[model samples]
Target chain A: MNYPNGKKGSLTQPSQSRPSGAGNHAFSNRGMTLEEDINETNRFYLDTDKAIIHKKPTPVQIVKVNYPKRSAAVITEAYFKQASTTDYNGVYRSKHIDFEAKETKNKTLFPLANIHNHQVAHMRSVVEHGGICFLLIRFTLYQETYFLPAEKLFQHWDDKLKGGRKSISYDQICQEGHQIPFQYQARIDYLAIIDKLYF
Target chain B: MNYPNGKKGSLTQPSQSRPSGAGNHAFSNRGMTLEEDINETNRFYLDTDKAIIHKKPTPVQIVKVNYPKRSAAVITEAYFKQASTTDYNGVYRSKHIDFEAKETKNKTLFPLANIHNHQVAHMRSVVEHGGICFLLIRFTLYQETYFLPAEKLFQHWDDKLKGGRKSISYDQICQEGHQIPFQYQARIDYLAIIDKLYF
Candidate 1:
């Protein structure tokens, strides 16, 4: 869990977190992190047939396979593949949905670099085609998650390229984003924002 | 490439013909066959700045790694993680483009079983939200590809569940799908249809 030479536990630290269940060790205090909570919420959504959202699977490339005696073939060599789309996407109330989820511990700001250029591009397309695209930013320090529309994020991202701030300030996020509440069942309560914005 | 199942020019065949640049061995074509072609098309899209689509990375649960003589660490033990989203996605003309690319040698129809329930559910969301969602089905035997929208595909899928035909006939596909031309550059010129339909 020790990251070398950088201020650890900042807003973007979760990027260093293991992408799957194993990453839980990094956030021992929180028990289940924001992803797990949202996953549970998504499951509830599916079970109830209210809305269908899912976190995309991680991509891998298998290089070698081993066929042991009288057993199923085993994959021996594989490498990770770059993802082309956002992490989460699905349907809600007959609408197409697409988005990415990010968590940061920094109390004051969220780094724009945490998002890849392609993801920004993907979100832009989602919005253009009439899909609701946004980022679920979790300020772990404040235990707060905000749904920031992609349009706003993209403007700030382009501005940064033209000598603006590297990150979006917490104040701006507070002003623009819908603050998502935490619940035991639907931990992120993102659907509340979705309902308000799209419905 | 001849498969043991009497199929010709199959990507799944270890003895299939390969283009010049790829590695020259049986080990190279070990993973999903269509994945590389789609990725190359995506790369072309990005390089040309035509669209910003990408295939999601594979999800792996890395259980163990071996450091052998300062080379790339060899992954010794791992398990595949289930995917929550479709394979390919991006933006075209400021719209969200998301889809799964599947190839079947069979010329008659596409099997609903090849696609998972979860993926269908995810596509449903894209349609609901107004995103251009579809399935790129390649009839390898016919050297033809079709872009079937989520709505059209889902209808047949629903009928299948109700004890209808297990597959969609090529005649039905011709009626429902928009033909995608295979250019040497883009490979599949799907956006043209998108332009005609959505624009």
Candidate 2:
């Protein structure tokens, strides 16, 4: 399929050769970050009229700005601020879709430290309000992305709070999460899983 | 009512007195900008479990950064980028809510120049996807905030494209739009109109 932008093969392929074995199987889309994959997928969804999701801009606290006479305003001093909500959110099939994409290099388990408390609270609010909330987690070692519902994530988060396992094992993820099938255009075809779960 | 953060009366009342006339009646919530009022209203909505809406962060293109040892990374150079979507969006009563807020100081008409072409396109996509979309316009001179539905906005937008009036008259806004009632907590109580119109 023809991609809208000419960034077709550049983002999906790895730049350098990797050692063979199980790692070789993860070569497809090796260099692309989970954020890039999801952004591409969201763009595809928008282009196809399938969804209207978008990644919110990175939050920043602007301290100073300089407006040149003939030029655009330049922000000279700023700092990154912790986001109060997830990275991506929008409407899909008349439902509000909210999710955070995370990637871990570990193959055995996904660490809970990647997520913050406020994000969990935000996800809970979304779920309570009848919106579709979840996590798009990519295990880089296997190049396998999984869709874990917010409800399922809350269980592990609560357990972590109660001094339980700090991470969800790969086996547990395999059991609880649905593997997102990678495609040429929609690299992370998450809506396919959403259709089955929600629709 | 007690406003959170103790910013109660500070933002609502003007710092100085105004001469008695049509302009005098606009003193309520005079100093606060449209953005500030809506943000305060959204915070109230969130606190009351009424809605889960939030304004997207201002999009910025970071060009340079300095990583000081044992200190937060400082963005040394950046420029504001145009947003691809509306300012505020979230879920309310199981329905996706998306909107852009604009303010006009002119008493007779609101210039269409405040909104961009891409924002209108984003609103159209939101509406086509069955999400509730609208514009919150604040007439600062009259202290009136109106909720103009996306469907109504498109007619005016298309007219502008066809070499029609570049601004929507105040009378037209009064006729086609619903005036949002100002409240103590929910400064720009827009959902009141949404409940009547959509729910």
Candidate 3:
């Protein structure tokens, strides 16, 4: 299928050496982190009146603060706390959208260790309460990002608890998950998958 | 109307002396801050499978970190960042829920300075996107908490920008907002108001 940005060739040939052209601009984004791309895409969605989503700030446990006479208070000692919920959440078309994003350089499989048990429980509760939840898994090696519904993730998660495979193979993900098209503005374009699966 | 948890008398008689009875236990919670009360209420909501809401972590800008050998990375230089969105957001009854909570010791008015311009803008966008948005205002002196819809807040917020009153009068809030009933488990029972207004 034709990708949204019409740069299908570049997506498939992620590592190919090509002459500097219009597509080179999109290739510059390759160095950007998944979080950066999603943040940019969320901004585009907000500016276009398509969605209201945001990444929650990193959880930090502040221990000490120093107040200078003529400056803002500075945190002197703090530690990072594990997030209990997913990274991104918001409203789209009157529905609550909740999801966590992860990029794996592994070409063979996506490790289950990347996700925490509490987050899986939280996602289950969100689904039970009638909210839309999913995971954005990006295979960095192939430049492929897949939108995996939370329900599909739960199956793999539950299997691991019962001594099944600790990771999901690349072939399994491609079969079970929807591939998110690359777009110039909306780099991740996961919402496009949402529109098809939900709306 | 009779309030939930059968503590209506305690809610109205904030300063009245009462015999140390079963109700006194509930009154002990008076010393808790609005944030503490809301956190407890949210925990109750989660435990009962009533809703899925969480307070976003405080936004912090980390500038320096020290990686001590065999120890967690310690943040050495960080500063608080202004939050662009509301504090609490999640889903309830198949609808997106978003809100900010504040407590005012002022008996007459809730100062508009307590809320930032960008936060007001964020609330407006949430409403436009079909989310259930509101404000949880607590009058500490009166021991009363009110759920103010974003629509009513916008009226006063816009008026303030146009050189009107810089604060919302307590009386006006009582007229335009729904008083959340004080409960034992759900300290600030805001969801009860949501059920009436949105469900």
Ranking by DockQ: 2, 3, 1
Model 1 chain A scores worst on lDDT over the 10 consecutive residues at A1-10
Query: Candidate 1's residue-wise lDDT over A1-199, tens digit each?
Result: 2233322333355543333333455656444466886898898887776776777776566787677898755667866555667888766765667888888767689999789987887777667656778999987655567899888899899999899999999999999898876555565668888899888
Q: Report lDDT (Cα) of residue A68, candidate 2.
A: 95
Inter-residue clash pairs, candidate 3: none
- State every prediction's TM-score relative to the real structure: 0.69, 0.88, 0.89
Error of 2 at A123 (Å): 0.2
Tell me the tens digit of each residue's lDDT in model 1 across B1-199.
Answer: 1123323333444444332234454544532345555776677876776776767666667766677786766676676666666877666775667899887766587887888887887787677655679988877655466889889989988998899988888888889998775455555667778888888
Q: Residue-wise lDDT of candidate 2 within A1-199, one digit each (tens)? A: 3333323232243431122344564643345667777988999999999999999999999999999999999999999999999999999999999999998877699999999999999999999998999999887656678999999999999999999999999999989999986667787789999999999
The per-model lDDT (C-alpha) reads: 0.71, 0.85, 0.85
Instruction: Pull out the clashing pairs in model 2.
Output: none
Ranking by TM-score: 3, 2, 1
TM-score (chain B) for candidate 1 is 0.78
- In terms of lDDT, the poorest run of 10 residues in model 3 chain B is B14-23
Best by lDDT: 3
Q: For residues A53-120, could you state the per-residue lDDT of candidate 3 as single tens digits?
A: 99999999999999999999999999999999999999999899999999886778999999999999
